[model samples]
Target: MLQAREGTCNWKANAASGMAVHDDCKLRFLELKAKRTHRFIVFKIEEKQKQVVVEKVGEPTQNYDDFTASLPVDECRYAVYDFDFVTAENCQKSRIFFIAWSPDTSRVRSKMIYASSKDRFKRELDGIQVELQATDPTEMGLDVIKSRAN
Candidate 1:
């Protein structure tokens, strides 16, 4: 059996103005953050010292997916997101949230994510990614959160 790891995913401002986290990395994080309606933007792939860096642009994106998707491809695209971990209704539970907008063409199943909530679901880190694709938030009986007026 697999075990879960206790670690936090850091959200930083995007290094590049127009980038996206590749087509595959959009996970539940993006979904949850979008629900929060935080102000942020995505950027395309950024390479330095032969390594790839994905981060939040620190800029607010109008259409989450559209902004990132707008990243220059043929070059490479990545969705860099910014988020804060705060104590939600469940004090003991820390909520990692993100706000984003993606086109309908964008999919949550593209990349691997940390499937379940730390205490609520599976106990594996990698499992989260697998689970992300396994279920659809809107269709999985999740509450419908309406978008606020801009």
Candidate 2:
């Protein structure tokens, strides 16, 4: 049987979930942040590897629809989106949103794992302004995001 090594820095595993956040996840996030190289990123837990991995990165030109379309209909995922909007004062602003998507149709086990690992994962990304959890598409619709941005 495989046993977890305590205090090992190589895998950044969370004690409660035994899930590690892959290094590339943070690296890609940095690119999106410092360079404006990406519009969004999608993350998923690889059950077999017990690690959270970067599954997709949306191009800078991609829209909200592209981000929404990236999420699986029957799975749980973690994502970060750079949302741009015009405020009431006509100021153009952008906010980095961290979204936890656990669709109702996903397996309970998957939902629980993602929930347990979310805090640890998000803590590593640094600079996320808004956090949203959704169990359905409507819960994360553009209108909802716009409201949250304000």
Candidate 3:
């Protein structure tokens, strides 16, 4: 079994414009502090299995399967997609949360992303590059999530 280690480093702004753990060595829980929304975007990665398990901390739970299905490929060696969106109860605007996990956890290659501006999402896997875009926010997020999964 893989040991789950939660990180407690000070939060810093990421390239995607959200708060993330300062140190890159931790691998248990990554918290993405939403700028627009106070709610947090968090998830965990299993180092041994190379799988990511996302918890619905402040996001809707109903669309998780769809989020997983929309991945670029049917199977993935290492990848993760997590985010928060506008819901019926939460009318406030929210940014999309994404985590691109590298296949090798021993090295630091994963990405923490928070996007809400563009329509297109791009990613590269196993030397293959893919770009996805949609007019809809949900679809666009799904496309990005799916692309990373591949």
Highest lDDT against the true fold, candidate? 2
TM-score (all chains, Cα) for each model = 0.24, 0.89, 0.20
State the RMSD for candidate 1.
Answer: 13.5
* Residue 95, model 2, lDDT: 92
Clashing pairs in model 2, backbone N/Cα/C closer than 3 A: none
Stretches off by above 4 angstroms in model 1 are 1-48, 54-61, 80-150
lDDT of 3 by residue, 1-150 (tens): 123222222222222323222232122223323122213223333334343344333433435555544443312212223344455575643333443322222233332221211111212111113323332335445545444443
Candidate 3 residues lying further than 4 Å off, grouped into runs, are 1-75, 92-150
Full-model lDDT for every candidate? 0.29, 0.93, 0.32
**Global lDDT for candidate 1?**
0.29
Look at candidate 1 and tell me the lDDT of residue 45: 26
Q: Can you write out model 2's per-residue Cα lDDT over 1-150, one digit (the tens) per residue?
A: 135454564355545558888999999999988898999999999999999999999999999999999999999999999999999999999999999999999999999889889898899899999999999999999999999998
Q: What local lDDT score does residue 80 receive in model 2, on the 0 to 100 scale? A: 99
- Extract clashing residue pairs from model 3: 71-146, 72-146
The predicted structure with the larger TM-score, 1 or 2, is 2
Clashing residue pairs in all predictions, respectively, total 29, 0, 2
